[model samples]
Target: MDEWVERALARFPNVPALFGWLGLDRRGHWLIQGERISHARIVETIARNYGVDDHGRWFFQNGPQRGYIALEYTPLIASVQADDTLMAHTGRAIESVSALYLDEDSTAVLDTPDGAALVQGADLAWVLDRLRADDSDKEIDDQALSNALAVPSGTQTDLTLVVGNDRLPVYRCDRADIPATLGFVQAPEPRDGENSN
Candidate 1:
């Protein structure tokens, strides 16, 4: 959260929190009443003020009002930069990465510094470039990736990726458990709070 936004909240301590009116789509675009939010400044403000509550619900603390955001896929999106680096859609530079998983739907999820965010498919090549055979640093192909997932034994070989100045290993996780593993609620319900303004 931005310090100014925090100050605004402190200034107007009785503003109401809005819900069901704001949303965050799969591509990281902000939406209002089912329409796309094209205003760059508003989007930037929302992004800058975005945060989560103690209940693990994501929201944009807009100046004095808290607008709970309903996410389409994930609360955040990790985009590939022109320099092959990764950044959150909210404009946060990815300093450290914990895990990465490619689902059957070709959706790549990343546990980055911001949070667990979905990586745009078009930018998956950066992740693929780092995946190598378990025993070697040689690159892996589609079939090889499948084989890594289809081991007959209990243990399976995972992949690896390098982020910033660290070499991190990627793990394969069922997409069904993403919310649990990442500790984020995809479909956050309404909360009970004082209706003030």
Candidate 2:
């Protein structure tokens, strides 16, 4: 195992670990030791067990869910799916070194390099503190950082003030749900005789 993976594993022994290169398919899904798991499963498990806020950040089972959500933080937009080809292409263009997956409550933290940890709640400050303390030379664009921090706090929507970076938009939701809300057309419905529709 690589040094980072080794360290991450030591940090988060319970959570699964995966590794991947910047753009290449040389990436592995979350796994317990050597057992591989699908990305869909990971997402589903996190969503079902951990509830994600509008900001796309996973949190612990505080409101509705009962467990923790697994977040995937990487420099590269590897798995981010979008309808616009240009956006997808752009995401693939920017390569990232490491990513982080943790619950909002900060109880379980997992990374590609195998450095994992458990904290109390969704302590963004603490996570940022640890990231800064680490020696990794990863570089994340300002916009990405802003998006990450844009997660809603309690019932306030004006939490944009928390983000110190002006480069990132104050309110941004890039997932598929955003497109749907923006009036993106769905696929055409088939005729009654067409394929039993």
Candidate 3:
């Protein structure tokens, strides 16, 4: 959150929070009422102000009002940078990745510094290239990949992803279990007794 936004919140402490007006798409695009936000400055500002609440709901603190974002997928979309580094859709650089998983949808979900992030669909190829046999530099074959995906969700597989100088074990995760496991709400709504208007 920005310093000015904090001051605004202090000045108008009773400003009502807004919901259902903001959303984040699978590709990391910001949406408003189902429409994409095209303005670069506005998008950047929202990204800068975005944060998660205690209830695991992600929101953008817009000056004095907090607007909860409806996420289409994971909270952040991870993109492979030219230098092979990872960056979140919110423009935050992923300094480190602690965990890795291949979801039922074949998308890579990573536990990054920002939070749990789904690798951008466009970067799946890059991820595939980095996948290796468990604890080995050998690239995994298609049959081995299939075998890994056959395991039940939440089970650690015999696969690993080569990230920079680290090799992180890969787990098989179901898409449905991602939210609870990652602790993020895909569709954020007001909690009991909270104002919906």
Candidate 4:
């Protein structure tokens, strides 16, 4: 949240919160009225102010008014920057790089920060770049990578991939338990038929 935006809330305390009008799509793009917001400045501004309420709803604080967002997937969306660094959409360093799972859309869901969030497909190479198995950190091979993706069914089994200086776990999450496993709401509906926008 921005400081100037906080002051605006105090100045005009009666502004109502908008519901289901704003949205954050899978690729970390902002959407308004079912269309992607084209202006970079406006999109960045809203992303900067994005936050979750007590009821587990994500919203953008537009000056004093709260514009609730309907999320197509998880709240956090990110990609690997040009420098090969993984970053969260909120512009934070994705820390602890714990676990990875492939979603139904074939997108990577990284378990870090707030619950699990989608990782851009192109950035996935970095996650797979240094992966190694067996008793040692041997250089990645074609067969090993293939075996990693096809883990035995009904198990927590996954391959250990090197992330930064640490070996992180990666696997394919079952489609049915995605929401339960990741601990995030895939689709959020407006509460109590409310529309503050």
Candidate 5:
């Protein structure tokens, strides 16, 4: 087990941990001990307590057990900003959890649930700001935007294409959800003029 997973297990005993590519299961569910929990339930819980957006995506920290969960999303090429309220809410959630592992004294430090030093006086705002900036949206064409919008809805559509150095996929998923084991190959280009070429 990763040391972070161990630490998280020790600290948050009630919380179940799981790690896999593709964010939550495609069916949007999680299994804990022998019981099952829906991803919608988790999102509801987080939203009710921490104020995440209904349509927003979440990034669960990767480890043998769950580490810290970051509620954010990659921007679609069309939109250049994440919901600001969602970003703030995520920062607050991190702050609350970090407080559980950190101490009050300026110099005091504790091991984070993920085993990193939960140093006192760290600027969480700065971290949140950086994350928000990293998730800043971009401009994409109409087709790309349409493809991205279709993914979460479970529509089977061609949303990605490789052109030169660009590996463009229209979906906005948690980065961790991308499978490392999978490799993409370019499709053969169509020959001139003939529609069936």
Candidate 6:
């Protein structure tokens, strides 16, 4: 959080948190009232203040007020950089990927230090290029990928994602189970007895 935002929080601790007004799309674009936020400065500021509450709900600390963000999928959206490094939507560099998951739609989800992130559609090719066979140096072929996707959800695929010097196991996860598996809430609602607007 910025210094001024911290000060504001201390000064007004009772400000009610806002909801349904802010959202994060799968492509990493921030939206307000379902409209994209194009202002660079505002977008950057929101990203800087973004965080998660104890309840697993992600939000942006807007000075004294909290603006909860409705996630389209995972809290973070990761993209592969030109140097093959991973970067999150919040502009944080992904140091390493601890786990990899593939949903029924074949979208890739990466568990990193920052959080579980869904790979951007544009970077799917990059992820495919790094896929390797289970416990082997050989890469997975087209048939291998097809077979992996054919397995039932919640099953471990015989595939691994090679990122940097780390090799992470790949699991088949259903889209409905993503939030619980990743430990995040996609659409956060107000808790019992809490105020929301």
Identify the runs in model 2 with alpha carbons over 4 angstroms from their true place.
1-35, 39-43, 52-82, 85-197
- Per residue, candidate 6 scores C-alpha lDDT tens digits across 107-168 of 99998777889999999998898899877777788999999899998888999888777788
lDDT of 1 at 51: 88
Per-residue CA lDDT of candidate 4, range 1-197, in tens? 88989999999987867766788887888889789997988977887898876666678899999887777777888788788777888787676667777544445677875656777767777666666665467666777666655664224434676777877676766655666676655545556755454
Q: In candidate 3, residue 73 scores what lDDT? A: 85
Say which candidate scores most in lDDT: 6
Best candidate per TM-score, number?
6
Candidate lDDT values, in order: 0.76, 0.28, 0.89, 0.72, 0.27, 0.90
Global fold similarity of model 3 (TM-score): 0.95
Per-residue lDDT over 81-149 for candidate 1, one digit per residue giving the tens place of the 0 to 100 score: 988777899998877788676554556788866678898878878777877766566888898788655
146-191 in candidate 2: lDDT tens per residue?
5444554221112121112211112223333222322221222223
Q: In candidate 3, what are the lDDT values of residues 1-197, reduced to their tens digit?
A: 89999999999988778998999999999999999999999999999999999988999999999999999888899898999888899888989887888888787899876778988888888888889886777788999899989999999898888878888888999998888888899999889887666
TM-score, prediction 1: 0.86
Candidate 4: pairs in clash: none
Pitting candidate 2 against candidate 3, the one with the higher TM-score is 3
Q: lDDT of model 1 at residue 144? A: 76
TM-score, one value per model: 0.86, 0.19, 0.95, 0.79, 0.19, 0.96
Candidate 3 or 1, higher lDDT: 3
Model 3: runs farther than 4 Å from truth? none
> How many steric clashes between backbone atoms does each model show?
0, 15, 0, 0, 5, 0
| Residue 29 of model 3, lDDT score | 95
- Find the number of clashing residue pairs for candidate 4: 0
* Residue 101 accuracy (lDDT) in model 2: 37
